[model samples]
Target: MTMEDKREPKRRNPAKTQARILDAAFELFSSQGYARTGMREVAERADVATSLVVRYFGTKAALFEQALVRAIYERGFFVRSKPNFGERMAALVVGDEEARIPAMMVLAIADLESREIAQKITRDVVLKSLADWLGPPDAQNRALHMLTLMNGFTIQTRHLRTGDVPPESVRWLARSLQAIVDEENAPVN
Candidate 1:
């Protein structure tokens, strides 16, 4: 065999490493929250070094944004179901009433902060991407209606989860809103 036979294949996959960091970041971030979790903690949890986490993700905010993005990605809800925004928004309350903390964290992020983050959450998930699906709002009020309904459902369901699945509570809100949208979407008499 030639000396070139001695060469070993690459041991670490960049994709796998990046995924590990992201997974660890999400675990720590979701449990402890962005403000509480540190790069060191994520690196330790991922079994990588602290510098590696920082090198890959930069500051805490950058790492956190990535983690939040991961949470959204792992959900992969939009891709699988591909429902209308209002339907998808209603769906959250319909399924999985067991745990809501992480989503509550997402809501808390919007509630606690005042910056581009809030707008990004609103624009990226609650509005533009999904709105683009709906083919443009008829008016400003209509836009607000869709956005607020989605962005607050988790927070709204906080009380409902304490007892039963709260179908009546969730359906009341979902159907009431759906009624108006459905009515507006209906053919004129």
Candidate 2:
């Protein structure tokens, strides 16, 4: 076959390329934190041109925000019944590696700009949405407490390498979380 006949056109799918870049950005940002991760590195990981990563995400802060949202909220942790909320959240804190990534990313990010983005998203979107889902009777305050507990548990379990949390511990945590979710125990204000 002639050289012209043998040549094949390059394939370009913006959606797939964007997704690959986002996944790479998520992995790197979660593992290395914001200041350490770079566009070139992300492009290398995603197997795309660095310019392409820039084109798709515009800025590192924007990329980080999107990656955080995709990693955290898209998991649908907030979509649950009140009765099983504690158990489900406890399980996530105990074993879900995916659930831990966003928390890790938030904790790891040292850059002020990136930290602000994380804080804004966590507060405006995640916290607000979770509080709304929880319903009233001090829902906002309870949601804050619940998130505090979960984030701490995730970081502690992940860093401590304390393998296999005891069933009793998990149960206690679940009950504690349930107390926050249930309006019966809310302090008289």
Instruction: Give the alpha-carbon lDDT of every model.
Output: 0.59, 0.80
Predicted structure 1: lDDT: 0.59
What digit string (tens of lDDT, one per residue) describes model 2 on residues 1-189?
Answer: 899988999889999888899899988887778888899999999999999999999999899888888776667777877786788778877775665555545555578888898788878988898899877887788888888887777666665656777788778879989888887455668
Query: What's model 2's lDDT at 76?
Result: 79
Off by over 4 Å in 1: 1-10, 73-89, 94-116, 124-126, 139-143, 159-162, 176-184, 187-189
Q: Tell me the TM-score of each prediction against the true structure.
A: 0.66, 0.84
Candidate 1: tens digits of C-alpha lDDT, residues 24-93: 8777765555567778889999999999888888887677666666666566544533334344557664
- Predicted structure 1: clash tally: 0
lDDT value for model 2:
0.80
- TM-score, predicted candidate 2 vs. hidden true structure: 0.84
User: Pick by lDDT: which candidate is best?
Assistant: 2
